[model samples]
Every structure is written in C-alpha cells, then in structure tokens.
Target: MAATGSVALALYYYYVRGETQRGQFVGLWPATILGLAVSLNLEQMKRMLQDFQN
Candidate 1:
C-alpha cells in the first residue's frame, strides 16, 4: 500500500507536475521501501525459528 502510494506520487511529479528530477528521485523510494520490508521480514522469520527451537 505504501509502495503504491510512493509510485503514484512519483508519477504525479514526473507527468502531471512535470518535475523530472524530483520524480526520478522519488521513483527510487518504492524499491527502497520494499527492500527494507523484505529484510525486516527475514529478520522476523529468523527470530521466530530460534524461538521455536528453544
């Protein structure tokens, strides 16, 4: 959901508002957010497995 919003904002800046530089910069946010989400999920799973073992 948050990633979708970020992409919409990026498109708005790029096409609607015609701010190329800003759009390009904002466009990178979704990937960053998703990457963090994946990393956090992995960490959470690791912790869950450790707890299960003990």
Candidate 2:
C-alpha cells in the first residue's frame, strides 16, 4: 500500500539524517518489510488477473 511505502521511506530518511549504525539497522527493517509486502501484493494481483482472463 502507499501508506506502507511512505512509512518505509520516512524511516529510511530518518536513519540517513541520524547517521548511526542503529538507525541504519532500524531503517533497513521498514525497507525490507515494504519490499516483501509489495512482492506479495504483486503475486495476488497476478492471480486476480489470471482468474479474470479465464
């Protein structure tokens, strides 16, 4: 979702600003989560499209 992506982006920005190892780790979490979410969503979407075609 857009909201999920936005949250991840915000976290990434925050870490960049803080410039610390901990911030870097926390920031990476959101990005990884967002990537997984998007990938899952895409798979679901593909299923929906295939169903519509049949």
Candidate 3:
C-alpha cells in the first residue's frame, strides 16, 4: 500500500509537477519499501519456525 502510494506520488511529481529529479528519487522508494517488507516478513517467519520447533 505504501509502495503504491509512493509510485502514484512519484508519477504525479514527474508528469504533473515536472520535477524529474524529485520523481526519480521518490520512484526509488517502492523498491526500498518492498525490500524492507520482505526482510521483515522473513524475520517474522524465522521466529515463527523457531517457536514451533521449541
């Protein structure tokens, strides 16, 4: 959801506002957000598996 919002905002900045650099900067955020989400989810899954093993 946050990633989607970031994409929309990036588009708006790029096309509507004509701020190419700012849009490009914001465009990079979705990947970072998704990467963080994946990392956190993997950590949570690891904890869950450990709990089950115990």
Highest lDDT among the candidates is held by which one? 3
Ranking by lDDT: 3, 1, 2
List the candidates' TM-scores in order: 0.94, 0.60, 0.95
Off by over 4 Å in 2: 1-19
- Misplaced by over 4 Å in model 3 are none
Tell me, by TM-score, which candidate is best. 3
* lDDT tens digits, residue span 1-54, model 1: 888999999999999999999999999999999999999999999999999999
- Predicted candidate 3 versus true structure: per-residue lDDT over 1-54, tens digit per residue: 999999999999999999999999999999999999999999999999999999
Question: Which 10 residues in a row give candidate 3 its minimum summed lDDT?
Answer: 11-20
Worst 10 residues of 2 by lDDT: 19-28
Error of 1 at 4 (Å): 0.6
**Candidate 1: where is the Cα deviation over 4 Å?**
none
- The clash count for each model shown is 0, 0, 0
